[model samples]
Target: MPKKRILHGRIVLKDDIISGYLEVENGKITGISLAKPAISTETEFFDYGSQYIFPGFIDAHVHSFSNPDEGFEATSIGAAVGGVTTFVDMPYDRPHPIDNAAQFNQKAAKIAGHSVVDIALWGTIPKVDGVSEIPGLVKAGAAAFKMSTFETDPFRFPKISDVDIYNSLALLKHSKIITAFHSENNEMIVELIRRLKEADKVYPRAHMMSRPIIVETTAVQRLCEIAKWTGGKLHIVHVSAPETVDIIEAYRQQGVDVTCETCYQYLLLDVHDLERMGPRAKMNPPLREPETVSGLWQRLAAGKINYITSDHVPWPAEAKQKGDQNIFLAPSGLPGIELLVLAMFDAGVATGKLSPQVFAQLLATNVAARFGFKNKGQIVLGKDADFAIIDPSQTTTITDAGLHTRTDAITPLAGKTLAGQVTATWLRGRPIYQRGQVVAPMDYGEFVPGAEFGNQLAPGGDGLVFEA
Candidate 1:
């Protein structure tokens, strides 16, 4: 007989919150009942009382390999502790990016060996003439493609030229795979940074001043137009300014399949925090002013944003501290996969700005739908039995010493307190994290392929192949 277990809690469903118990058998949710079922000798049962039983959170943006010291083992462990059962790893690895089939396959193998929770991967193209690899990557199980308007590294995270962007989009227009971008105007930011450095203004605030809101809006607007023209699905990652959201909304209204996600820092922290915290709070498309943060919240409440992500980059202290006096020298991004769910609950749900259902949507449901993780996300029958059980009455204090990532001592959120605490996390009906311990094996996680995994590929001439 298949092993059976019962979990009782305040189940957070897609549309409603119910006081119910879920039945799990063979790692899948088989039945849900509002009333507790009769006890059976062969079944094990665990009751979580008033805690919220959320579908395991899915962070659509994570950088496990951005820092060579931090890899799948550390990031996935941190994710499990944060109640994130699965995450989509970015393609920009340290040595090389996943731009072709061989790289994608190698990364996929690494994920299966090291990750403790489920993981998906994003693919990208080379700096030029890389469109030909798209069909091969899709067949190799790349969840989506990521490009950039602003260049981070000329070779690894290069800015895609307009012509290449158009060509890539045209190729992926019918693949139903999203093409996400790190949208920022390269020329404007480069010029501003040059001027700032020349003037000897290396303060933390200068980082924001260098990459103003217009830098983001202009790039996003251009990408949206290209997506509209090519009919490609477009996604803007880590949107900070409200004006950028307005631009995305305008394009979305025109029937373009465009969506945007805002990081928790954008909604909860502001430029003031950046000025106060220095490089610790520093990230690309820097935090907006107080007014802009408020405006972003308004947009989120109005349902203009599709989802939220951590943009979790576990850069070592040396990488962030290098810019202490010269803020422009530090790399962008910070570690947040371990704090995203807890912090969001404290600010969005406990403050009543978001209900439990909406919180689940932003963190899990919408992410799954957007990234094509059909078997994960919601707490429904026939889905994987993954969950993040949160105790509303409990409190968690953030500290670098307590973090699971390799760069635990380098986050801006240290010493912060969040309202709720994740009491336990379940992945595929197995307890991966509970009572501050990671219970799963290092190789327990598996690679989750994207929506275009097994599609047929055929020649479309000009040395290009198209999904048939």
Candidate 2:
């Protein structure tokens, strides 16, 4: 057995945030005890004083290869600095979309030696003949599978009909896998955008006007109906409105077996910011009114929302520089992988809007449990030694120069001051980020798939449900 070192600090575990000591041996937790002087003469030790030690966060929904300029390393560095130990990236527009087992393995081989932290991939299950690839892809280590209910590009994201959706779900019935849906009625939005553009009202507001609350609510309602009809596990990715959460809560009350997540942008920013930032704030399912933000916080406080992810998609300003033309031409997504954890801690914990347990549940535990990552999410003895030392009193202003991502676009929270900051992060008891810089091994991550709870979603199936 390897020798142990005692780390003393203000520790934040699953349901308790207390000042204590933690022992680590061979990159795993050994014990949690009250703070005291060392008994063994040869014992090694590190003290964090008053800093808060929290389990490293996991980004459940992210686009690893979305931004052209912000390549893999940039995103990884940003993630590390943000105290994220594992990133579950979607496989939508990569050079090789996950169509077959061969292509899935090819992409896995590409990311095998590139990441600095743990990674899980979301495979694309095309609505065509590619339905047969689900089992093989899962066996080959796909983190989850994603499909759009709306129409998408022919080769990239093929939309599936209701019959095809059920067919794919039936094939994956025994696999106990998670099926994530984009959750928008494509034909409705397409027609709305067409009419708005023809009427010469294609502004940023028009984008929101095109995809109304009914667009998302109707899709979510349909997904719940499908889940009730078929017992397939489903996850709704990147929810935008308060009404959506109400619907999800109601579904859970009715016992629907669904798990859903909302992004940081939806919780923090509002529609007024979009008017000022223009294309910078123009993301899919545009930000809603301030009352919606309040409703989301209430749900978050009540433990109704499952996870909080960054959905970190960073497109350079040059790529989204067409704000003058139609807003439809502008690319969606914003950069926040480096600031998500800090923002959540400050807004959720410091403000007293959420309990520390809710913070952990939304940021870590629920994500790990929902996705089936056996070694991640918790600070338990048998789990992976992934943690971050946070200084809640330290304040910083968000700015472009302070970021670590490859893209040059500014953060939406730029100029806003936030309390609490991540001082260091550890993966498997080895330091990956310290003193605001990355220090982890470069080739240090592996892919996880179809873990134990892969098919066992939350109890009251509340949220969008897609079969495949």
Candidate 3:
């Protein structure tokens, strides 16, 4: 018989939270009992008492290589400390994007060697004729395909043409794989920024003015129509407006397979923070007004939004300092993998606006189901024994010096006190993070293939030969 381990705690399940114990054997959950079970000398027992045992979080949006300084090793360490067992890395890497089977294979190899926690990869297409590479990447185990309506970099992150978008959707109509997008109107944002620069309005608020809510909503609406026409599944990332959720819901009601996710910053911080923190708080689809932020919280509580993500990007201080005088000069995004779970639990659950079950759904369950992580995201039988144990009585104060990421000073939430501290984190029944340190080896993580992986590959083939 395999060695068994039993953990006793306040387990948060799919429908309820109960005082119980969970049994693990060979890295899989074997049994769960609401009442305490008999512990024998053969089974190792660990008691957490009243601490909450949540399913290890899954952050759907992450950019480990966006800043080459912060690669899989550092990012995965931060993720483990934050109680995230699995994260889906974006395809927009620094030197070269993963847009083909060869590039995807290289990245997968890197993940296996460098990451300390499980990682799933996203793939993208090149600027021109990129849709042709989709099938190959899908076979290479890409969790999803990401495209952008607004071009950040012409070669690294290009805006997909309408024709290409339509073609890609049509080709993937039957695959059931999600094609996500950075939805913002490029033309409108460019024109607005041109005018702002001409008027010398380079203040922090200019970031919000250049890309308003209309820019995001308009692009989302167009994508929804295309998905409607081709029957492709669609996802919008880092949505900042409440009305955008309304738009997605309207399309969802019409039977279009459309979903949207909001980042934790959008819920915890408002446009005021963008102005207050300047470049440090800069991000694409900039933060919304305070009223809009409140409306977004209401939509989240109402279950109109599908899930939440960190959009974890760790840019250096110099990158953000460039925008100290001109907001647009700074690169967008901030580090969040190390703080997403703690911040959300403090603001949402500790405040009594959200229950523990809803918190798990937003951060873990929905992300797993949406991204096709079959073995993760729950604490039930047959699932991976991944957990984030939290002691609610303890509080954590965010600080740059305490961060595990490379660029710790780039976040605006530094010094914020959050309720509940992560006491330990387990990945596949192994303790990866405990008592403020990562205990797992760098190569402990494994690659998680997408749902369409098996269907795309030919049987008994080492190379990517598409199945007819």
Q: Estimate each model's TM-score.
A: 0.97, 0.92, 0.96
| Alpha-carbon shift of residue 22 in model 2 (angstroms) | 1.3
What is the lDDT of every predicted structure here?
0.90, 0.77, 0.90
Prediction 2 global C-alpha lDDT: 0.77
TM-score of 3: 0.96
Q: What is residue 34's positional error in candidate 3, in angstroms? A: 1.8
Residue-level lDDT tens digits of model 1 in 274-362: 99989889998898789999999999999999999999996778778998999998888988898899999999999999999999999
Candidate numbers, best TM-score first, in rank order? 1, 3, 2
Which structure is stronger by TM-score: 1 or 2?
Answer: 1
The residue-by-residue lDDT of candidate 2 on 1-468, one tens digit each, is: 456677778888877887888877787887888857565755577688898888878998777676544556777788888889888877775555676767778767766667777777788776676766766777777777888777656667667777656655555545556778888888899899889989999777887888887889888888877765666677888888778878877887887777889888888888888877778888877888888888888777777789999878877777677774778888888887777888888788889887766777788899988877888898888788888788888976788667778547767788888888888888877778888668866787656564622343223232235578
RMSD of 2: 3.9
TM-score leader: 1
Q: List candidate 2 stretches off by more than 4 Å.
A: 1-3, 37-44, 452-468
Model 2 alpha-carbon miss at residue 330, Å: 0.8
Model 2 weakest lDDT span, ten residues long: 453-462
